[model samples]
Target chain A: MTTETHLVVAVLTVVAVAVIVRMVRRGVLKAKYTVLWLTVGLVLAVAASVPTLLDTVADRLGIWYQPTLFLMLAIGFLLLVAMHFSYELSRLEKRVRALAEELALLRGPVPDDTADGGATGDGSG
Target chain B: MRTAVIIPAFDEADALPAVLAELAAHVPDHEVVVVDDGSTDGTHRVAAAAGATCLRLPFNLGIGGALRLGFRYAATQGFDRAYQFDADGQHDASQIPALLAGLDDADMVVGSRFSDDRGYRVGRSRGLAMALLRLLVRRVTGRRFTDTSSGFRAFRRPVLEFFATEYPMEYMESVEALVLAVRSGFTVREVPVVMHDRAAGTASNRNLRLAYHFVRLLIVLLAGGRATGHTPQVAR
Candidate 1:
């Protein structure tokens, strides 16, 4: 790898780590999710700083280009994150639907369904 | 046994009044609950004025979500049976008794427009879509449903409770709900009823929407019914 390429990767990894830390501090991102981002950033930094490590791994895997190995790893990491988010989203959707049902019930009866000639002032309008 | 009529209405202020009036006149003994699906107009007020219970959703959850809310209300309120009626005035209130009567031998009763030699006109595209859905449902459930998309239906307590907890929140929920009901070991029967066109406003099903709905419903049914562990409770 060129010295300039190494420098770029190092700077990008540092920036990502800084951003994740800021998000965690601001409570925009939870600590649990931040761990995943931090690990990803640290792995990128390690691979970029030690190009020989990437080269050996790529050679063992019969890859002609070492950079392609790094690209593949980054893609794999992103795919994992996306799948995790999908599962979280599915859970959150179910919770939201359940909450909505509860809220509707709490809002009280529609006038005709009630027994006492319709409760006049429940603010259901 | 107590019964609740669940009407899920979205922006149907013009049409809802008459439907509610018909319910009040014909089915006064039953409880009428209109789920106002976050209409921008006076749907909630109209339903209230017509002496129907109005459950106002904060936003539009579409027909499926609104009906689920209605089901939840019915189940929680200790209703023995629940009927799904349309706010667009397409479903005849007078036929509700027949639907409930048809429920005597089944867990769920569907008011089918194509049953009992009842002639209801359908557009070419919609007729074709209904035919395809009928074929798919028959293939999967080993039962023939002449009108799989009919919104007018009645459900006994167990089926109502099941749908209250889990229902398809998508475009063609009626079709999907049928699949779910039959797959979950609930018997569904169809009774012929005369259905009229919307008294006011337009239906949401246009050419493009119908095409999209057909593809989506086909995918959902083909993917198999939703995995709801709803064991049928003993009927009351």
Candidate 2:
């Protein structure tokens, strides 16, 4: 059972667009990443709707296997996204560490985790 | 000169009481600041009862983080100098004056155990690693150091204030801090000092973690990290 490349990619584009829209509407994805996935969706939409677009581009690039071009581009894009995520994660970790140190400095030698501070407060009402 | 002893303790309650007592007996004029590294034990109470100003961290941020807080506290309180002493009683309080005496000539004094025949022994691989680290330190800072990881060290007000915010937060931070200070153009010296075996509690040395941190430190040393600490903010 052989499936045509256009049909497969078309189905994938529909599913990807639906999932991306749902995720964005549900507020699960941040605006920055939402823009990223939306751009990915738009590229997929262009490739699927204009069935000859990938073939035309791949042909111009002299790639005999059109799907190879798609796969290569996808892999490259994913690698860049992964690298960006790693950079962001390192930055966030540093900020969080700084916050932890700041919190410790502000809390002083005493810990307000216990109910003692609240209990001693004027709860006369 | 106003001096502070920065003791970073994590579950060393058994040994800390004696350590604090010795510090009090030996260096009465020096203020002691104990950083309780989120110990589940009553380490804060031990430090407080011993008349040491204890800063209890919300959670364990490792030894580097604890010392940073202690340094920050000491600097903000206007202490002219500070020395780090082990909470396990491995560090002798009598030698504190000798450590501080080094401040007369250098901005930072590292109490190196290998400077003389102090008989401090480690495993063969660990010794190799330390030797490699010593080489790396010498290469990066353009200076020689016999011990790169000795916790027994002292710093003047300028260096203490500098480390208040810029101390490395990594596991093996002493070496990194050493490199940072030297790279930032501060004078550093290593002096021979005698340290004892822990009177209580096990040393926190895991080969796996140590090896991992060793590789990370190799990268840090070779990679030319944030070495721009030569700001004019710190007064001479």
Candidate 3:
């Protein structure tokens, strides 16, 4: 609840929100992803402004230190963001595989008379 | 049915010419596709010079990715069967007929090296890994497979289409693909085939990498589910 700590938190929150908004406006960050970052920034700002709210929540959770609570929440938020990135990575990997398959097939030879003959047979020699 | 031989090559410039030659001599009737998996050598040129239809990937996509592309080509080009062969010259092209013969009753036919004691021996580590995979696949599919990691195999049209849509892009895709096939209601069989040591180029799996790959593949096979939803084609 020190004045200096409050000033630092306020500045950091403002910078985070401004950067996120600028990225969103430049289309570098999609709206869906921006929402998560925006929420994190807003929560930090609110927690920093209402210093007593942090102490009350920490007391209810049986934590002696209020900063630890903030630290735990920040860590949990980061873990969720990391999990979301992993899901996005998995999806992109699948799409890349599909695209690679399509590109290779496009580069292959056209089906011809021999291909037709091969298709009609019993495929047993 | 029309059959195409899909050879997935990665930096096999030294061995591709002879492999293509043997394939041309042994199975000239079948369409041959050499998918050059972003080799930094003359692999594409060698395949093209040998008269095999060569598809060069812009970058390396490993064996699984290359084979998936082959399946896509087979399915889209209306091939009735697609045969997977290795460009390392380890797979015998002459055994392709036996694979095709097995296709008469099965949706997928694997050219197994251990089915009839063809005398193909692996190192202790690889043997143990293969044994574990065989047991896992047998338990999952209720059918025993002697060579679950064999790259040489043949697939019917429906199986080709299924794999073209979805396949494992992992270290042990060969074994995983078989599990996928069996789980998707496709009949799978194995035929004995002789294999040779690589004519050239070092194996992608070796030493520390092999150990890591074995662990990773074990986890993936144990945790993964069926990869496709296509119903098996009725027996011809």
Tell me what fraction of the real C-alpha contacts between chains A and B each candidate also makes: 0.32, 0.25, 0.30
What lDDT tens digits, residue by residue, belong to model 3 across residues B149-176? 8888999999998887676677667878
Query: Across residues A33-76, which tens digit of lDDT does each residue of candidate 3 receive?
Result: 88888887889789777877878898999988667887798798
Instruction: List model 1 lDDT by residue over B99-216, tens digit each.
Output: 9998899999999998867678887877888899999999888999899989989999999888986778877788889988998899899998989865332787566877887898
User: Which pairs clash in the backbone of model 3?
Assistant: A118-B1, A118-B2, A119-B2, A121-B1, A122-B1, A123-B1
lDDT for each residue of candidate 2 in B1-236, tens digit (9 for 90 to 100): 89999999999889898998999899999888898888887787777767788787778888888888788888898999999999988788888878888999999999988999889777789789999999999998889999999999999999998998788888888999999989878889988898886533277677788889899989989997852212223222
Q: RMSD, each candidate, Å?
A: 4.1, 4.8, 7.0
Better of 2 and 3 by TM-score: 3
Tens-digit lDDT track of model 1 for A32-111: 89888888878877876786787789899999876788789889988999999998887776666656656667777545
Misplaced by over 4 Å in model 2 are: A1-4, A111-125, B198-201, B227-236
Question: lDDT, candidate 3, residue A87?
Answer: 86
Of 1 and 2, the candidate ahead on lDDT is 2
Q: Rank the candidates by DockQ, best first.
A: 1, 2, 3
Instruction: Judge candidate 3 at residue A6 and give its lDDT.
Output: 64
TM-score of 1: 0.89
Q: Against the true two-chain complex, what DockQ does each candidate achieve? A: 0.36, 0.27, 0.23
Clashing pairs in 1: A110-B53, A110-B54, A111-B53
Q: How well is each residue in A5-35 modelled by candidate 2, as lDDT tens digits?
A: 8888989999999999999999999999999
